[model samples]
Target: MSRLRIHRFAFLGDARPFGDREVIAEPREALEPRVRLGERPTDGLQAERHFAADEIGDGHGQAGIERRRGGRVHGGASISAHARARPGRAQKSAIPDNPRRKRGGIVEVPFRLRFAFAMNLSLYVVTVLIWGTTWIAIKWQLGSVPPPVSIAWRFWLAAAAMFVLLRAMRRPILPPRDAWRFLVAQGFALFCLNFLCFYYSEQVVPSGLVAVVFSTAPLLNSINGRLFMGRPLRQSAIAGALLGLAGIGCLFWQQMAGHVDDRATWIGLAIALAGTMCFSAGNLLSSRMQAMGLHPLATNGWAMLIGATILTAGSIAAGLPLAPDTSPRYLAALVYLAVPGSVIGFTAYLTLVGRIGPERAAYCTVLFPIVALAVSTVFEGYRWSPVAVAGLMLVVAGNLVAFDLTRRFFVRTA
Candidate 1:
């Protein structure tokens, strides 16, 4: 490095040393030193001299460059002086070191994080299987039991189990004051009313049929969202929705043509439709509750408790059948319904809502019917007619269309 000695020059007037013996002009008169350096060139001359001598620049020089002219270098001195240093051409730091950088720009998580996500995802799969299988189990259980009795028993048992589990974990069963109303409403919709209609429908209609009816919930939500919440449907959403409805219409037509004379079956189908509407409405309710800062599990627990109480009271008041010769098989089914179906399923589903959002997670409804059909075939000897098979294919196609999966397939083909 070539070293340069700079002399005090009043004519140069508060200039910075550039190359050997050259003083760069002070940015402007605004940057003129308060004290005239001509009278006492040697006064602050020490600072300038030291700065000129030092390869590592001094504070004033740095300050002169930074503040007055965009300084590019600074010496290790006082902070104020360091602050004045030339704003060094910022070295491109490591991504983690960058302050203004965005996340989601990189795959930052390690394999360990990916493995953890996979485990959580596996738990979700277990939840789905449990939920799907229980639909058939629920149908079987409802065969002999009154709908309210069965619903009440399932929830009471679940609440008991949850209470025990919570006690073990030292978690509180009682919620805070503000949450009671939401919990009650949630309970009514999710537990009492939803299950009441579903179980009653399943008693008359096939479980697989109930599953198909429930699959239309997203389509219902689309309408509900548009009407109540003023969410405008995109053209793609509209087109997909129409296609899905057309598919459902094909299935409905097959069912009606095959079994049009069964009034009881039609009643059951009507009840199932009502139950599904309630279920879809609950989605919006749950979303609202979440926005109000309630945890889904806590809301569900409270709601289940309220639902159980209401159903029990309603059963007694209506002089409905209470006991159903509860066998071990029935009891085991109830346990499964309460724990895995009600608790684990809701927990996993709500978590999924938080992760991927409500709309995307609801795609589970499409898959759920397929699961129900498969389970029914195995357990209940549900033989699919040729028409039924065609209906099933339509349902699958509808779901693909609704979810834009078929759109991608077509794009790829094209």
Candidate 2:
């Protein structure tokens, strides 16, 4: 006869019995022909014995034993098998059902979060490149047309193209009546007044200099967000803003030192700053519209149309030419400004404002100057000075500090 081997399995939280009996039995009775191990007897002795043995070990011990068995335990005797057999008293899962939970001490990012991050990064790159180049394109539009008229034409073409694209996608072109009020306001601030100021500023200043003044947008966005949206004022952001302002002053000082008593330069700086403020306001409006379930492209589409209409009427009343520029370079610039600069660039930027908060989204303004200055060097003969370089560094440093990138890097490394 085979020797009676008692396998004790302990389950930490389980109170169920295991094997045939609760007490140990002598080998003669345990291995009796009537107490067959392979098959159950009609008196239910084998079932009782199996459960009695299982009750001896903790859940961890049972898990260890099951693993040791290479998950090939026979007779439905494993802890998992027991849980399956008795559904009510089954052990709960060790891994959480929450998608964000860590497994084996490693945290996992969900697919949606990764995809969103990628999209935001791509949008940032695209917005920076387009907006940077748009300053030069705006210069091309200045020779033959009034500033407001040029702006009107640019946005009018942009609005028409947006509508055509929307129609192609079978998306609704008209905003809801309730949204029209906000769309009108967005139009004035973003498409109409902002561009008008910027275009006029470009006439008096180098486009790169205008871009430098406009780089104050992140600071303005933060202040506006705190005042209107009730976002908490961060010390880092405030410090960053001050540093950026100082940098701008340094750059301006360099310019003034070179050309003192230039009224147009001062006026251009003031107008560019005002336009930046308007840009920040538009950011907030776009954010609000996004919160209200209005898509950025749709809002921008309607707003551009309203802005174009108003600008067109204003230009007509002001006796500005309503005729389009026929020059190849001017036309090319207009098309580029309408499509990529206004349509694609605004869509990408406002989408970022919705995805990230407006304050963070405005950092793109900080980056825009670098691209603008590079383009200006090639086209407008922009020369970099030591003071200007220092100012740029300070501005870049401020942004890093404001966004907490510096702290995050240290923390991650530590």
Candidate 3:
């Protein structure tokens, strides 16, 4: 007399595709104590398949008794190994979570973050440090190599590194033919043009200035989402955008001061704006690709290869220099971009875009600058001006408005 409860399983990252699974467990107490804290399995089958005893704290309880007692099966359930292999397969019988009825071995987890703020904070800091310093790294490579050439070489190296890593793990390198064009477009917009604009703009403006300007990416993305996809535009979105824009204006005004006539600075800033536009465009493109069921990591790898080809072609056409002295700083920066910045950052960002959609994820651009500012403070001894402080405050306020963080505050307070 087993009560069948169908369970579905979903994976967090691109390592696995989205698939449903079914598991028969007692309708009542089938999943109680065995579900781990913060473990979000799609269904009971997934829980049984992925969760370990150590991972799930309590013993598996009986059906009707626990169903009537514990209120609901909010957490903990284990899926059988057989259930995971053929996700489409129908369940034969109820999978119990009883400690006394333990059967198979535990699945090994690759990495565990425990959903701690400190863990997230650390990851955020690492991401920003890698990104912020890359600005200076990018600046250093400017005269030594042509912009497009540098980008081509950087991505070639990145592609190579990613290839080796993926291949070592025996991950498939080949993707469908249709995926190539989309990957190339993404790479060009995301890696090539995005970097080119930023680098060239830096030639005209300070890195800090370029960063401050790029912070508007989220606002642009929000607008793009609304116009392109017909997503509902919230008032908070408009307010948030305006607040962020006003903050940028403050920074611009402060920087311009009596030097507003500086043509080069203005030009550079304009280019920076253009680069941000490209970044926003890439976000939209990636969103489309995700919808098509392409994994971000695989797509990014292929796109980098495509971007590398396009950039190299451009470099050849322009007779740009391709070589840079393989100094420690240069190599280090390149590796950082290849791994943490390009690989890790793109993966995180794209996945986030897939989950929350591009608009909300663009918030990372805003926060990333704060990370950059902190790095600037340490490495370059950057100090805030009174006006800069005001601008920072405005930026924070604007971000709150744009993302509707204010709503969260009110909700919590209420």
Candidate 4:
């Protein structure tokens, strides 16, 4: 009698999604791991389903395995794979880990902390750096074009490129029908109104003041997350956010000084606040979409398309010319903003929000000023003052606190 071995599997049916499960079975090996649909009927016990490996790791994607008794299935001992196409490819069984698997007697870092943190950090850095530098490009996009029209052009190009990229990768471009309503809300808030408010606000207020207001995003996200999503208010995240806000204010203190009593200044501040709220709302929407199994690329692509259309319509109604600026500076900035700033930046950012929680991820807004100032220093003659240097340290401190990075290295592992 040949013995059957269980390779990869997940528990099917109900609340247990894929964390810590034990199936009682000398599971069959001929059952391909990747083929997720398998029902093992028991003698009056609940029907059990198995999957090979899935996204939660050890395999790939989401899957589950239910506990069985004496390693037997219903009235039968085993079953074959359900036909999900594999053209002439042999299935490879993974090696089982040794009970005492150890690396030189040193425990390894937890995958949740180790792998997830590293990837999230990379995404976070890319998002901050790309968006930060885009301010300069946005400045280039300003003259000879209405800011709204320029923004419309940026998103049109961004959405087009994003769809092309998604098609090349064979990822789904359309979200579920249920998702479009939220997609519209997200497109309006994040892509359309957010940019419009910011562009207009910057005209009235000092850019630094606008940035200072924008830095409040993490706090607002935290509050909204707790109220709407029921996510807990983390002390460390709040502390970090407050610290980052202070750092940002210090960093831009000089530039931020202006006629605060001016009516236009107050209006600009109000507009900046509205834009920040829109941004926070978008963050929440992205989280919700991810929970719905919608990828950031898909959501952003759709949202960008919707946003561009809306902006273009509004610009047309406002009597702005829908002409393109073909100057080298304008074209270069448009390309950079469309691809790197909008596409890459938003995807990386929203993905981070899904992984790290919105509050912690919104801390990226705080870091934006640091990168923007650095770029400004190089290209626009920005001089760093002692206050600014102190501000930089505070911002760094805030990120450390926000991420809670220290505990991972010193984590007590078994």
**Cα error, candidate 1, residue 377 (Å):** 3.5
- Candidate 3 or 1, higher TM-score: 3
Candidate whose lDDT is highest: 4
Candidate lDDT values, in order: 0.55, 0.65, 0.59, 0.72
lDDT score, residue 59, model 3? 14
Residue 272 of model 4, lDDT score: 96
- TM-score leaderboard ranking: 4, 2, 3, 1
Question: What are the runs in model 2 whose C-alpha is more than 4 Å off?
Answer: 1-107, 206-209, 247-253, 258-265, 378-383
Error of 2 at 349 (Å): 0.6
Q: Which has the higher TM-score value, candidate number 2 or candidate number 4?
A: 4
Clashes of 1: 7
lDDT of 2 by residue, 321-344 (tens): 899889999999999999999989
Candidate 3 Cα outliers beyond 4 Å, as residue runs: 1-129, 248-253, 412-414
RMSD (Cα, Å) for all candidates, in order, is 20.1, 20.0, 10.1, 9.5
Native-vs-model 3 lDDT? Answer: 0.59
Relative to the true structure, candidate 4 reaches a TM of 0.76
lDDT measured at residue 312 in model 4 versus the true structure, 0 to 100: 96
Better of 1 and 3 by lDDT: 3
Model 4, position 282: C-alpha lDDT score: 98
Q: What are the per-residue Cα lDDT tens digits for candidate 4 across 1-414?
A: 112223222221112212222322222221343222233323333222222221111121222233224433331223323311133433222232334633442222244234544666678899999999999889888778998899999999999998999899897787789999989999999999999999999888998899899999999998998898766687778988999999998998987776677999999999999999999999989878766657788899999999999999998999999998989999999999999999999999987776566888899999898888888888889999999999899998887777665443456743
